[model samples]
Target: MARKKTDQKGDRLESIRDAHNAEKMARTTRMEDYLEVIYELIQHKGYATTVDISNYLNVSSPSVTKMLQRLSESGHVNYEKYRGITLTEAGVAVAKNMHDRHGVLAEFLMMIGVDEDTANRDAEGIEHHLHPETLKKLEEFVKLAKNQGLFR
Candidate 1:
């Protein structure tokens, strides 16, 4: 009975991990782009208004409104129409994770001699497709580079 419980627990953990990864993998580029923008808006401005997001993303106001509606409905964002938008807890976690990935990729590229502009652009494109393991390795590489005073 105890052995069976341990096995069941392990299986549950594995299932949860798989589900989390699937959610990450299932995100479309459009969703990621929106999340990234929302993350930035929240970080920089403390709150995200439709007008602010539209201007920051250079997207039309109508497009921003449509996406925000979808995001709010999907539980990624909290909306109150006139009040503004905030990310739900799960959405906050996802945004932070994606932003960290972008920062890590950008730093790695810069450490390896890519120009800042190119690194930023490339990181934005590459972070979405990179496997978690590859990102782990890149993160380690960045840490090692920093330890070696490569940034100085």
Candidate 2:
């Protein structure tokens, strides 16, 4: 039988590495999602409100407020209570990046015969985690496939 609790004591040495990376991805994902919604709202409607964002994202109003406050603190948006929300330049850059990523992934999936709605949904799910190199290759494949009339 496996030794159930070996007597070797836990290490007394220092921790191996920093703890920033895991949380970084989570935080970045949240930031990107919020920014993407805000960007779409602004693009189509000329304004973004907490209620609109909450509705688009399907999060509670309070949750949206809390996140907006955090984003305000981070220089991603100009948020004022009951006023309005606007993405700063930095925020616009990130949001536009996510939007482009979504477009590419969805188009690629559709090129592979996935339906449009499912391609878009799956793109939203996975767009945040793609590496730059992998995304570049997929983008290239989609571009060439379209141009060469291979997937059409």
Candidate 3:
């Protein structure tokens, strides 16, 4: 009986670990943060540089260099010295997804009367934490509110 109890507990622990791993995979990783910022900068301004990214993110150039190297190795970005960086296909997809999440959350926050700057700042943090289902609902609600001419 004790053997069976131990086995059951082990199984439960494994299941919990698996759930945590899945959740971790579902959300963005820290590296993704850099990629997302580059993606946004590229989209808005047509190019991104190490200095601009460093300034916007408030990180050192050395730190950004380390991450850019990792991202390049992971096939998420193409980095070169004295030249701008660009995202690969996989990187673009991830960046676009992150951007969409930020857009939806920011719009939702603004719809509820949050100021533009605060909403954007809050959305940047909230986007990483929101689950897919919750983000979907928030997007839908924001769309509906916009249709109703609410919060204009």
Candidate 4:
């Protein structure tokens, strides 16, 4: 039937959309992890190295190198072999957004009685998947809770 065919077409479209979203999310999460590590390392040490990134990410050195190459190609970083790594302007923007989001999420979880370590770990797990609107609302909630003296 034409109706049955239409329904199947709709289902196929929805499946495609879901697959696209999943791939986007995976890329975003991976990129966020790398950017956050680079940002944090640079903050602490004024530089980031492949070995440091590998250690922080718990990934192999070759894996970090490969990803860094891709990031460089994408204009997200300035990377040279055996030299320090630095984020490009676009990379800094993404890294700063991610940093703010991570801080708010971890602070919220801590206010809810989660330990610092656990809150940070959990924030990293879910940060890239959060909708911007949801993160905004959560940020406001954390602020309100702070104003109310709701947690230590």
Candidate 5:
């Protein structure tokens, strides 16, 4: 029937959309990790090189180079071979957001009596998956706890 065909077409489209979304999310996660590391390295040192990133992430230099090339093509980073990497404005914005999220999550864990080491480890695992609303709530909670002298 026509209705059956329509439904099948809709299902096929939905499946494709779901696949696309999943792939996009995976790429975003990887990009976020790289941006976070690059932000830290730049803050600590003067710049971030592929070798520095590979060493920091414990990944291969080739892998780092490949990702950097992808990031550069995507406009998140400006990469020149044999030179260092620098984030563009958009990349800096993403990195700053990620850094703030990490801090807020880590602070919340610490407020709840999680050990410093454990809090850092847990925050790293948990930060990327949190929704914006959840992060906002966590930030508010951290602020409230700090105001109430709950943090030592």
Candidate 6:
């Protein structure tokens, strides 16, 4: 029947959308983690090696290499065979955004009486899921709290 075929087509489209969403989420999370780590390492050490990233993330070297390759292909980083990793401008922008998001979340948690360690831990988990509008609101809240001496 025509109706049955239409329903099947709709189902297929829905399935495709769901799969695409899942893939995008996974990629976003991965890129966020890698960029953040690379940013920190480069800030501290002037370069980020695959071994350093592997150790920092507790992932294997090969895994880090694979992800770094993907990141390089995505124009996020410049990867060389044995030199080190460097964030491209796009990568730096992403890393900076992620870092700011983490800081705002952690500060908010601390302002609300969460311990430093717990605040950092919780912020890391919460930062990736927040929308831009939600993060903007949070930033405003933190500013207000700071003005009120709530963080002290």
If both were scored by TM-score, which would come out higher, candidate 1 or candidate 4? 4
Model 6 C-alpha lDDT per residue in residues 79-116, reported as the tens digit of each score:
98797899999999999998999999999999889999
- Per-model TM against the reference: 0.77, 0.83, 0.78, 0.83, 0.82, 0.83
The alpha-carbon RMSD values of the candidates against the true structure, listed in the order shown, are 8.3, 6.7, 5.5, 4.8, 6.5, 6.6
lDDT (Cα, tens digit) per residue for candidate 4, span 9-125: 999999889867886755557877898899999999999999999999999999999999988988889999988799999989889989999999999999988999999999988
Q: Rate the local accuracy (lDDT) of all candidates.
A: 0.86, 0.87, 0.86, 0.89, 0.88, 0.90
Extract clashing residue pairs from model 6: none
Tell me the spans in candidate 2 whose CA falls farther than 4 Å from its real position: 1-27
Using lDDT as the measure, what is the rank order of every candidate, best first?
Answer: 6, 4, 5, 2, 1, 3
lDDT-superior candidate, 3 or 4: 4
**Candidate 3 lDDT, 44-137, residue by residue in tens:** 9999999988998899999899889888888899998777799999899888988899999888888788999999999888777666898998
Candidate 1 residue pairs in clash (backbone atoms < 3 Å): none
For candidate 2, list the clashing residue pairs, or say none.
none
Model 3 error, position 8 (Å): 21
43-113 per-residue lDDT for model 5 (tens digits) = 99979989889988889999999999999998889998897899999789888988999899988898889
How big is the positional error of residue 12 in model 2, measured in Å on the Cα after superposition?
28
Q: Give the local distance difference test score of model 6.
A: 0.90
TM-score of 1: 0.77
Clashes of each: 0, 0, 0, 0, 0, 0
Model 1 lDDT tens row, 1-152 = 99999999999999889867886768766777888888888899788889988887789989988998888888899977788889999788778888999999999888889999999999999887777898999899889879999773
lDDT: worst 10-residue window of model 4: 19-28
Residue 66 displacement in candidate 5 (angstroms): 0.6
Q: What is the lDDT of residue 151 in candidate 1?
A: 75
